[model samples]
Every structure is written in structure tokens, then in C-alpha cells.
Target: MFAEFRKFVMRGNVLDLAVAVIIGAAFATITKSLTDDVIMPVVGWIFGGFDFSSYFIRLGPIPEGYTGSVNNYAALKEAGVPLLGYGAFVTTVINFLILAFIIFLIVRSVNRMLARFEHQKPEVPAAEPTDVVLLREIRDELRKRPAE
Candidate 1:
């Protein structure tokens, strides 16, 4: 049972999955940074500096007429506020779009490269004109020579 478990753990698919998970985590970080740091900022600038990161709604009773900017999401929750956190969602959506676009470009390029590679595979050489007929002709000539 231990050997079987070890074999299963060392299987090709398991290793492939582990590698994929690690790569996916790294890629997620890159996409998150790209969205939050570069792409979202440009998009926000285009939309009159409208920051989606700060767009949240506080749904609770105002505590003793206290008015202060909520810094973190934890603070809002700590203040007993029911919140609508759409900014993070918007950032996630943007990240997804960028990741999808990059993947599409990669797949498209790979397909084009594969098509060119297949086209260069030398055309199967057209079946080589069948040597059976020539063999039969030689056999008939030898038979006639024996008779002569």
C-alpha cells in the first residue's frame, strides 16, 4: 500500500498538476499586479481619474455621527457595516480579461506555427508508383527465356 501510494504520488499527471498549479499561482500574481498597477490606473485616468478601488458602499447605522475614511476592508467590517465591495470585483474582472487576451494571443500564435510545420512535412511522397507491375514483367521475361 505504501509503494502504491508512492507510485501514485510520483505519477506524471500528479507532477504535471503540481507544476501547473505553481505556474498558475505565479501567473495570477503577475496578472494581479498588471491589472492593479498599470492597466487599471490607465483605465481610471481615461475615465476622469475614477478609481474603482475605492468604490464601496457602507450599509450600517452611523456611529455617533462619526465620519472618517475607511482605510481597509477589515475596518469597514469591524465597524459593523454591511459592505458592497465592487472595486475588488472590478479589478478581478480586468485581470481576467487581460489574462484571457494574453492566452488567446499565445494559442493563436502556436496554431499558426503548427500549421506551418505541418505544411512543411514533405507531402507523403505520392505512394512511390507501385513496383509490383515491374516485378511481374521481369518474371514473365525470365519464364520466356527458360522456354527459349
Candidate 2:
């Protein structure tokens, strides 16, 4: 059973999947950072400095013991406020779109490269079998002989 488990884990596809998962996690982090740190900031600037992350609707009254500003979404949520955090949801959606777009571009480029490689490959004709070649040679020799 141990050997079987090792065999399964050592398979090329399994290893490749593991590596892909690790790289995918790293890529997701990069996409998240790009969305949160760069694109969101630019979008906020374009929209007159309106931060999307702060856009939420308060569903319940703030806790009496909460000392954070009422306008602060994160602080209010942390203090057990029931709020509809649509801004955070939007940010997450944007992150997903960015990651998906990047993956699509990568897949498209790899497909194009594969297509080019296939097009450039030289197609060699298959060689005839030894019996077929010998038969042809015999027919040629017979044709070359004088009529008897």
C-alpha cells in the first residue's frame, strides 16, 4: 500500500499538478496585489478618489462598545457589525477577472506557439516495407528482360 501510494504520488501528472497548484497560488497572490495595490488605486483616482473598499451598507446598529469610526468599514466589521460589504466583493471579483484574463492570455500564447511549431515541422513520408521494395525490384528486373 505504501509503495502504491508512493507510485501514485510520483507520477508525472501528479507532480505536474502539485507544481501547478503552487504556482497558481503564487500567481493568485500577485493578481490580488495588482488588483488591490495598483488597479484599484488608479480606478479610485479616476472616480474622484472614491475608494471602493469603503462602500458598504450598514445592516445593523454599531456595537455600543465599538470605539472605531462609524465610517470605517473594516473597523466596523471587526467590531461585529452586520454590513453588506459590496466594495470588498467588487474588489474580489476584479481580482478574479484579472487572474482569469492572465491565464487566458497565457493559454492563447501557448496554443499559438504550438500551432506554429506544428506548421513548421517537416513531414517525412513513411518508408515502404522491405517486402514491398523487393517486389517492386523484382517487377522492374522482369520488365528489363527480353521477351521470350
TM-score for each model: 0.71, 0.91
lDDT of 1 by residue, 30-113 (tens): 988989898888777776755666566777654564455565555666666788777767878889998889879989999999
How much is the lDDT of residue 85 in candidate 1?
72
Q: Lowest-scoring 10 consecutive residues by lDDT in candidate 1?
A: 65-74
What are the per-model numbers of colliding residue pairs?
0, 0
Global lDDT scores for all candidate models: 0.79, 0.92
- Candidate 1 ranges with C-alpha deviation above 4 Å: 62-74, 77-80, 123-148
lDDT of 1 at 146: 50
- How far off is residue 48 in model 2, in Å? 4.1
C-alpha RMSD by candidate, in order: 4.3, 1.5
